[model samples]
Target: MAQNVKRRERDTAAAQVIAETFPPNVIDTLLAEAKETGTPIDGVDGLLNQMTKAVLERALRAEMTDHLGYESGDPSGNGSGNSRNGTSVKTVSTRNGPVDIEVPRDRNSTFEPMIVPKRARRIGNLDDTILSLYSRGMTTRDIEAHLREVYGVQASRELISNVTDVVVDEIKTWQSRPLDEVYPIMYVDGIRLRVKDNGVVSTKVAYLAIGVDTDGRKHALGCWIQDSEGAKFWQKVLADLRNRGVRDVLIVCCDGLTGLPDAVTAVFPDSIVQTCVVHVIRNAMRFVSYGDRKAVVKAMKDIYTAPTLEAAELGLAAFDTAFGARYPGAVDVWRHAWAEFIPFLDFPPELRKIVYTTNAIESINFQLRKITKNRGHFPDKDAAMKLLYLGLRNISSQRGGESGTGTHGWKVALNSLVNLFPGRLSF
Candidate 1:
């Protein structure tokens, strides 16, 4: 009896390791079937379905044997009360197609199969399929139609919603999770989306923050939904980051939102606030004509790309002289943002590139925009937050599983940052 138990344990362990190479005989049989039937090997009635059925049935059989503590027809099981009671036919939907297989039963009726649960009608990681589709911005109705048409599975809208609803709690936990003690670089920005409230649709801003750790790997700190972006709301966001364990941030990159720089320094006095150069340029361009835009852009590049802070100021002066009269507002933008913008001019190119703009976070916002474009307007705040959270998680996976980006030339950038901020950047 003990030997039988040990052998069963060995079998279970072996079954857990999926074989990379299948038996040659099985392949030959499948090929022969396809040739004889003149069917594609990967179609509904093809090798995948056959293999899925065989693997599921085999797993069920193994489960039954484990449950009974003895193999079929073993004399040691002659007096065992919970003996095999054969199997019942069960049809399950899979990615390939519908597969009908046998589910083993026990005499005592306690054999619960894990591969295909007692009532599970569909298989092949369907929840993941729904999430992948949902993260890619598909509506639940769209996902339902996609499953039904592509996989021949009749999934209801409610079922699809329930699958994605699991992300709500995940978002809550992720938002409040503890962060690293210090981040080398941080970028914050807002993207607008519509949400419904009290039967009225209003535009709301989704504020996102991305932090680059000491290792130079980017981590999406969190997302916040607000009626509008302001320093008061940003103070709250910064406080939350502090409460969650972020002690110091070397630099905070953001747009020229009024009082935003004060909010950053208020929360982390040691942190330098760097206004995004791209935002400054865009704001300046807003007041320029299409014809003069090229010349203006060229002049503006001289200021930002200057080798020294004094040189950049000279470049800005040169720009003011050339276009200041016609595009005074454009020149004023540079003048207003000059203090926050010149910080990059003091750094080497490697470090400057890392902190010059909030482009890293903007890329993430672009992806979220794509996800929410079809949404029109979310029914409520949580609905909007849930979808955005899932979208970020999906985006992170696509960019090599990091919350932000594994920036190219990160090693060189880190070395430059280390030399620039003596005691600030600790591993």
Candidate 2:
């Protein structure tokens, strides 16, 4: 009798395992139908699509039950103040594709669905997915078709527009937000894009100021789009920056734009405006013949790489004799920018590299260019601002913009700055 009872227990355990492994789940029913009809299970009408729909539907029903305080077919729910109403069908986009799901409703109309909101046309990561594609130079139409073909989700152009439009408020808040009171070095530059102005398409410039604070991390202080680049506009931009915060700036590095030094000096009187050395070299290279280019570039290189101000001056005199007559325009360019250029040379070799070049801001321009490449023209400055802001938002999140750029050797450079200027880079 004991052996018979033990055999029965073993038999029951085996049956239970079989049931758990191959139960009457939605997939089983789907696969059974697929096998009998020999239909593929990866298409829009495939078993996988059906399974996603079923899972999401179950989640929606659960959300509704929680809100209504009863489960389906529960008799206790009848006398409750609010009861389950029939489900409503809504088309939603998923990573897998677009699926039509039934969202449960309540009789009192107070049931707010949290799993999938009533007004949400796209679910899950669809918003982020489309925004990412847009940031990588994909047009709305291209994004729309890509979703349909790759994920089997049909996203209308208007829906895509609305999804991206959500960033406008975020952009406004970020643009007007307060900034760090003191930055060790600031690199300012412009990224140009075509945007609509008063119904006419025009080229607009997005001027961005990137700062390296006391911690060696990179921060984009602000980005502003205007009809064109101008000193008056920049003065206002600088004033706006002052309004937000920025009590003191130790050094401002930039490609020399006429009147920019004055504009920055006006807002930050004590801030030294150091012209970017790389820009001077690139501009100087234009007039030299290909054969003489290397020689001219090397001689010009000697000026900035000099160990002392006297040595740099000697290098400049030598450069004048070698190539000044042949490329007088280039010579004049450097001579004019000499005052601002001299500030960077006063630093230690470690600190000079960080301040003498605009590498940080240039990398940011490359990022902004990719975002604006797909759009022929933005509807207006606000639209352009919104899209560019979203792109910056993504870049900052990826690079931890708040914590600074944290690039290699920056800590060593910051230490050099502190050593060179005693009280400039402290909290």
Candidate 3:
């Protein structure tokens, strides 16, 4: 009984607030009409839909009257150079499905409707709906049919293409935007994409870089397409970064791409290039026998998890001693990457996680794969980049905002880097 009394008091307060918010009898009259006509108060083809159509039409009529400097049916419009010519029926997609309304016209064809512009078939958030679908790998034709089936709106394929094509310009601008002067760490990696070139389908590489800025924010720097991943191409990409205002980078974590370490040294001479520990382990596993794979991984973990650089070197020597005769190639892999592998061991665990691997960009590559998996091959380079740009934007948006600033445990990591690198990092 007491709980029921509290519920009733809450309900009474909400009703009082509603009554004070709207004018007298407005809510009651609308509810009564909805009941009298047996129409829903919300949803598509309901009272709200009817009211939206009515309101839009009435507002349009008011606009027409103002445009002509006279009221509807007023004698002052008789001699006016441009008078009401009647309305033409137009169906536009809206959040509440499609709305069919009559749009006013003028005699001289000079009065343009600002609310619903001429030749506009979509209003409000409908464009956003289409974009959201497109970013998820839906083709233009698929979006057109989806809009028709779900929203009861007939959108042409050309219209959908026009909407998605706008992202091309955005990609161009975002590709060349200036970069921050310093980033504590940057992750670089590449993903394969099938793209059509010269009327033949071929696999291409899309190089991506994700930078963790001063505030520990991760932002996707850029995407570059090439026939294959090579050190020369990476040199050009690094050059582009320098040109874009990246004066200093404390550390760059990347895979064991051949010559990548020398490339980093050439471009940002002060930056430490760390080979991805995860990649090194994975590469080493390929040379191990099926029966001994688990044991090999255990031995490898000791080297990476060691406390200090000297301890890590001892750990690597021990790993080589135990597995050296059985799997020389696996030991060779570690030896080849040893220079790049030892940098993270110098830092504490807080900073070690930031430079341990290229997993930061690897997660992004996974999402881009999911978005592009449906297509057998993109039509062209531009189409692939456009979709990629949109997919990155969508991923960033879902994470809360662009770059998703204030990475978890970032404050602790930043403090460590400041003391370790001294003047390199700017807060």
Tell me each candidate's RMSD, in Å, in order: 5.8, 10.1, 7.2
Measured with C-alpha atoms, the lDDT of residue 138 in candidate 1 is 96
lDDT of 1 by residue, 234-266 (tens): 899999999999999988898976667888888
Better of 1 and 3 by lDDT: 1
- Evaluate residue 51 in candidate 1 and report its C-alpha lDDT on the 0 to 100 scale: 83
> Model 3, poorest ten-residue lDDT window?
1-10
**1 or 3, which is superior by TM-score?**
3
By lDDT, the candidates rank as 1, 3, 2
Which stretches of candidate 2 lie above 4 Å from their native place?
Answer: 1-43, 46-48, 105-110
Give the number of colliding residue pairs in candidate 2: 4
The whole-model lDDT of each prediction reads: 0.85, 0.81, 0.85
Candidate 1, residue 131: the lDDT equals 85
lDDT of 3 by residue, 210-255 (tens): 8889988888888999897667888899999989999988899998
Q: For model 3, what is the error of residue 14's alpha carbon versus the real structure, in angstroms, after optimal superposition?
A: 22
Any residue pairs clashing in model 3, and if so which? none
Q: What does the lDDT come to for candidate 3?
A: 0.85
Top lDDT: which candidate number?
1
lDDT at 247, model 3: 90
